[model samples]
Target chain A: MQDKKQLITIKGTREGLTLFIDELCSFNEAIKELHDKIIKNKPKKDDPIVSVRIKLGNRYLEDDQDKQLTEIINQANGFKIDSIESEVIRKEDALKWKEDSKIKAINRIVRSGQVLEVKGDLLLIGDVNPGGKVVSTGNIYIMGNLYGIAHAGVDGDRNACIVASYMKPTQLRIADYISRAPDYESDGVYMECGLVDEGQDKIIIDRLQVLSNKRKELSRFERRVQNG
Target chain B: MGEAIVITSGKGGVGKTTTSANIGTALALMEKKVCLIDTDIGLRNLDVVMGLENRIIYDIVDVIEERCKLKQALIKDKRFDYLTLLPAAQTSDKTAVTTDGMKKIISELKQEYDYIIIDCPAGIEQGFQNAIAGADRAIVVTTPEKSSVRDADRIIGLIEKEDMKEPPRLIINRIRNHMMKSGDMIDIDDIVQLLSIDLIGVVIDDEEVIKASNKGEPVALHPNTKSSIAYRNIARRILGETVPLQSLEDEKGMFQKVKKFFGIRA
Candidate 1:
């Protein structure tokens, strides 16, 4: 049994510690070995809780095998043994996190009647066609041309901004306020649009105009009153 | 193996019935044994569009409930040798046909026919579920208008939830080229971009479609009509033929040109 312990290996991952059960031993014996190893490696009472993942051979555990494993896990101390069914759990969790962190898109063109709604910041790798919409809770970033409606700061985050390679949106909304494109043809330039103030009370469209005039106006008024 | 295709649009009046009728007819014309099931139940119009409403003595409900045989309920198309219509019961509501009934009927039909085309009713209700219950693929129909496209988008999302092997293709119907060109209407690119689906067909807005529907004749039967041509082209594409999409802009003739000159837009 002491030499049998050398066959099994344990390593830690993002989710929990992975224990590789050796194929040489019967599934029941492997479960016993795993339980004993876990008991010996149990962390001190002051240490943080550690989770464990049991990895059986290529063949999936039978119903009877799972029952035996569960009994072993219950008997073990200071550690919880979880079965790693597939690699999908980790990948899906990562994908969910990626989706929540930012809105990433590789669309060639966003056509009319299409509404693309993202929870976080939106990053589109293509053009937003007329009548299409991109709504996000955070900042909106378009790698290509934007010719449709884009609403940033959907959850009322005033610091949110809309950036595009060619910023020619039909209508843009940041926080609460919205601004429509000028009627006449304007100089085609890559631009960023956002609200400069903390509360996002004003809408400003600028081609590299870092300090919004609206913000300057408020500050200038405050300075004059203070001097007086 | 026979394939089941569901034709659905979440919004009403976006040409789901019309597309179903035309596509089924076109498939039949191609000599594929096709059965078109109208899953709209109480509000069925596939029978009317296919010119078999008067002939529907026994409906899908009667067949599923074992009140009548499946053969007794199936109405064969007079014009097409390979096509049949399973009309929905006008007297009974959508609940009359359950998803299990639809799955069993479609499975039974799959053994006999090359294609089973379900004419899904508008809305993502029990009727829609019944229609898509055994569908192998789906074709979503939408118009250029905002409401129709929005509904189509919703339907597409629902179809995705079904976890079908293939994504549903999009059919943008009733596109008025003159209106689109004048910037008065939503363009095809915009619809495609928003839906993010492969284009199956684009049906132009034609007065002849209404005329054909009124006469209980599908527009696909009228080969000379532009809408008919569009339907036939869609059918050919469904048959896996590499056919170029017919340009809706090409139908803008002298009258449409005159309308444009007069600044009149639809």
Candidate 2:
């Protein structure tokens, strides 16, 4: 009884019941404990289905072990595994996450018919000529004129924004929303940013200053520098 | 040994054939052995513009398909002993010539000529691909119009993406003084800056160019017309000369002075 109690703990919260597997226990021991507890506390047949989440605190499970843990919880009557989360991740996944968060810098003109794409954020230092297109999964920062098409958050990230030194793009897309430039001429002096407005349900082009207000995370470095 | 320059414009009726004829003639007149290859295939007009239409005994298709030797297919220009023309086949389509065949033929011509000017067809298709296959340099020609500039931008993008030796240069053709003054036409500076390429020359719109083309003579044959001077300047620039850009105001001012001398209305 003491060993089983030390191996796993079950708690109920507003979200659902959570099964906290002890990090110090062996994989086989935790699986056994989880199976016993779920079977012992199985809800009555008339009771509603109880969604349970598993928390692997500081413990990493192989694919088969993770599947085995889920199978044990799901097999119990009236209970299903909602999610399985671990504090540790695979090295390849960590590297991919790092890469997706990194900003790619390109210095060249995006002429007509040319398409420039990046997996993460993009920092373009040259003009995007008419007929050219730029696509990124994250935010896009252009230090030159944008007279073509720019699509930010191509993977459907609605929070992604596109900022350009000259906001004369023919079309701007953020996530699922697309807005074409009006028939007005830009003075080509002030910078502008295109961001999605949740309430308005369309992209709005505003001054560059609005970027800091909307995307506070983008100014984290500047904030840290100022605080120091 | 020699440089092959492809003159391309993504849109049609923007004077690609006229530019090729004039530039080839200007270069040949400068004492360089120049070969003008019309790669328009079915729509071949460079030979017609160069007045060598009847002399084409064997066209480029015959040369590429190995039906005739490259020397036999080449028609020497009637005026300039050094200038030559390899006419496009009037009957065959663009698919008849492959990029590999073009590379082979261009390599052979490069060995014998100082400059090989290829006149590319309009639109970004197999014809464009075949035209630019063996060229070492590219000259994108455009006019002062929204659609023309847009197409020129596309052609420039295609050329640079191919990783050519140097970036393609720009030639803004058919610039009108009155339309520019009235702000109806796109400015030369705007086109150059928008395309973001080097500006080789800007040819003013002149009726003399049309007359010369109708007569099967390149305007560059006569050195006096504004259009002819523009083509000659472009040819010189191709030869690494540092000629100054021609100003529209000078020509307009000269016209105003002529009107005053003739006692015309102010």
Candidate 3:
């Protein structure tokens, strides 16, 4: 019977030593364990191979966090990093890895000169101030005001729409069509949605509730398939 | 330690150079040794603004490339014993001044001058980054215009991420008391609220400022007009003196001027 390791799993491959941190333990604890283990294995005064590789399985490492981990390994026992294998485990075309399921949600105000781009659906819970921009390949949903520029359906998805609490934007683009806000737009704050008008093949703006009703029907179709 | 301050306005023609020259001259007048550096290389205007264009035998590029000693590149202000102007390179571009080079130059100047005011060029490009490289503090200058205020907002956001010792202060330059009164221009409170920073000073629009610039004299040299008072107050505030915003604080005088101009009998 083999006892399960708590912190990390070390495997000696033909290339070099590979260290895998346990997912259950905290990152700080794993880092400390890795440091102690490297120092403990610091072969006497001379070691031929004094480097190891760290493979982070299915974990996103921010720049600073990666820097910290590398610094920890470098400063201890003269062991340098051979390679950092950031295995994100992305499964292309798998059942669970649907491209349409990807959604980017941001909850802060986008100020001037700020650019927010997303590949799939995007949901913004804050305002997009003037000089800001939001670009997406799929639908865009803004819970707050849209005072900046927004472009949806960038990759020829005409069905994609942009919904915002206030639709006074510098410019709006859907699929191949583009629309600019009229100079004399009403000053009232109202929820609105922008989408392509199939009949005219032009982008148009209307109340957000109209688009929400359409979304409700689409979700209803999805729910019927799931129930069956 | 001496503070290396950069006076930056993201938009052009918003009075950053004017603020730098005034602040430097004011600090020097207070008996503090000051060095005014113009980092707007290739498009140098600080010397012309200070009326010291004829004294620039050596520019910032000369000192950085080791062609001349630091002191040789500095043009001393004839009016003040403690003030000097380090002119920018007129022919060389902003790339000539590297951030690391600026850090070294600023550190060397720190040993001599009590305050180093860098006149940053407009735009958040190489010039902006180079000027801010060694700054311990920042002074963001802006006007009441929408474009100016928007750029100022962006600059403040950049300044926040700059990891400086302290956040930058705001100076609303060229404020017309009349425009503000008639609601044609943004108010001080609105500008402050939008920029979201400490309001250090508010300078009123004075015709004398243009006259002073032509003569290579900073407005702070004189103590008469509202422009002069505003610049002097800014200097006092920079020297750790708590000065109120004279333009907004004394609304009685401005109100009377507005009323007199419009011929309102009340």
Q: Which candidate achieves the best TM-score against the true structure?
A: 2
Q: How far is A185's C-alpha from truth in model 2 (Å)?
A: 6.0
Regions of model 1 farther than 4 Å from truth: A1-138, A142-157, A164-191, A196-200, A208-228, B249-266
lDDT of 2 at B30: 94
lDDT of 1 by residue, A1-228 (tens): 455456468888997788776766776667766777767876777776667786666545666877777776656555675655432234565665555454466565565556788876778888776677888876688887787898987877666678788877788898787888889976546766555445545676765466454334322323322221
Say which docking band candidate 1 falls in.
incorrect
Residue-by-residue lDDT tens digits, candidate 1, B1-266? 68899999899998999999999888888899999999998998998888888898999999889999898899989897799999999999988889899999999999989989999998888999999999999999999998888678767767877968799999999999889999778889978876789999999999999999988988888779888888988888888897888877574688888999999993
Backbone clash pairs for candidate 1 read A111-B189, A111-B190, A111-B193, A112-B190, A112-B191, A114-B194
Deviation from native of the Cα of residue B168 in model 1, angstroms: 2.2
| Model 3 clashing residue pairs (backbone) | B50-B216, B51-B216
Comparing 2 with 3 on TM-score, the higher-scoring candidate is 2
Question: What TM-score does the first chain of candidate 1 have?
Answer: 0.46
Superposition error at B240 for model 1 (Å): 0.6
**Chain B TM-score, all predictions listed:** 0.93, 0.95, 0.93
lDDT of 2 by residue, A1-228 (tens): 554357888899887799888998789988887777777888999998888888998998888987788788778778877888788887987676766677899999998888999987899999998889999988899999998999998988888899998888889999889998777865543588999988899998888888778889775533322221
Answer with 2 or 3, whichever has the higher lDDT: 2
Model 3 residue A161 CA deviation in Å: 3.9
lDDT of every predicted structure (CA atoms) = 0.80, 0.89, 0.84
- Which prediction has the highest DockQ against the true structure? 2
List ranges where model 3 is wrong by over 4 Å. A1-90, A94-103, A107-112, A123-127, A141-145, A157-159, A163-167, A184-192, A196-202, A217-228, B29-32, B150-162, B166-168, B186-199, B236-243, B248-265
Candidates' interface RMSDs, in order? 5.4, 0.8, 1.6
